[model samples]
Target: MPMPQEYQLASQHYESFLTAAREALHLTTRNQTYTCVQATLLVFRHRLTAEQILMFADTLPAVLRAIFTSGWSIDDFKPEFGDEGDWKAEVKAVRVDHNFSNDETPARVAAVLRQHVDLPRFEKVLQQIGPDALRFWGFEASARI
Candidate 1:
């Protein structure tokens, strides 16, 4: 496909995420990876404050950024999730039609997301959400770098 000149970089970023998410989740289709990325982003996005969410979205590649913020409802701020299970459950619920086999999907998705985004910028965004953000994204102290 011939991406527009402006879309080149954005496509590259999305492709990077697609490749990472697909391999991480052991999914076959780019569509499944896309769904996983969207689901994962929604899981994290709802937990963030409005300010943090905007800032984080701005830092993402264009296509992924839109996916991150898509279908968001700010009418009710989501409560802080307790652990990986809580967040994973929400993600699965978002994509209920798909079966997420590995119990570790959330952590694996987070690991792939970290690989794709600009870590320093993401770390700054994470700071706004606090330590729970780090744990929620499955990033440890070492992964912060």
Candidate 2:
């Protein structure tokens, strides 16, 4: 089925945000992760459009199932834009570096996001994504970077 333009565009924007989050949260040795941001974005997008919510809602289960059962690599998930795609699989694509500290991840992410994207825009994306998507991604973040 053909996806609506709004849904496509929103998805694209969300991907952009994901890239930004990854860049913002980069660590030296520990991998940079964005499951939190991704989950929040999915929830935010859901708030903006019913179709987007439905579409993402449908796809997420399968992706998680694949992650759970098949042991697919998170790095295999292609980025839509120019992101370097240097991430690790933790139920979702999370960036990790062998040198980064555990506690620095979230703060680094927040800082990078502030540098690249504004607060309102960030919150807007999170607000639109649905609860289920948030919960799904949240599961991945059970062990936060």
Candidate 3:
């Protein structure tokens, strides 16, 4: 009957996430943090099947769900999960000139995200998505968060 809390407070939640991400990444601005977070999410998105991507997005907070799905092209080629270095390269390539993502971006973003989401549910989805997804988010396949 009424609007959801997530919708009502979407801006607050998103700003809080950006604040946390900026602190975790040691960045000075939300724009920089946004680019880094977006890039990291895109790198992971490119590795998932369309269905898996939707499943993963479902576990995210409202604003993050929006971020995850924004600009997605179902027809785009899915990339294989290469080494961690490859992941970082892809993340940093998002907006090459403005991107500030680094080697620790994915793991750091994961840490911040874990604090904001329902960890058990998130981990469960990651598990369902398979081990590579777990590793992409900086969790060991057998590890429980």
Q: Which candidate's TM-score is highest?
A: 3
lDDT of 3 by residue, 1-145 (tens): 8999978998898889889999999999888999999998888998888899999999998989999999899875476778788888888889999998888898899889988888889989999988888988878986653
Candidate 2 wrongly placed segments (more than 4 Å): 1-6, 27-32, 36-101, 112-145
lDDT of 2 by residue, 21-131 (tens): 556556222123435444323322323344444444344323321222242333333223121121112313233332232343434444444443344443334344534
Output the better candidate (1/2) by TM-score: 1
TM-score of each: 0.83, 0.28, 0.93
User: In model 3, what is the error at residue 81, expressed in angstroms?
Assistant: 1.7
Model 1, global lDDT = 0.75
On the 0 to 100 scale, the lDDT of residue 74 in model 1 is 88
lDDT of 1 by residue, 10-94 (tens): 7777787788888889989987777666777787887777887888887777888888887778853677646677777777777
Q: Which scores greater on lDDT, model 2 or model 3?
A: 3
Candidate 3 lands at a TM-score of 0.93
Superposed model 1: Cα runs more than 4 Å off: 1-7, 99-101, 141-145
Candidate 2, position 59, lDDT? 40
Q: Report the number of the highest-lDDT candidate.
A: 3
The lDDT per prediction is 0.75, 0.37, 0.88
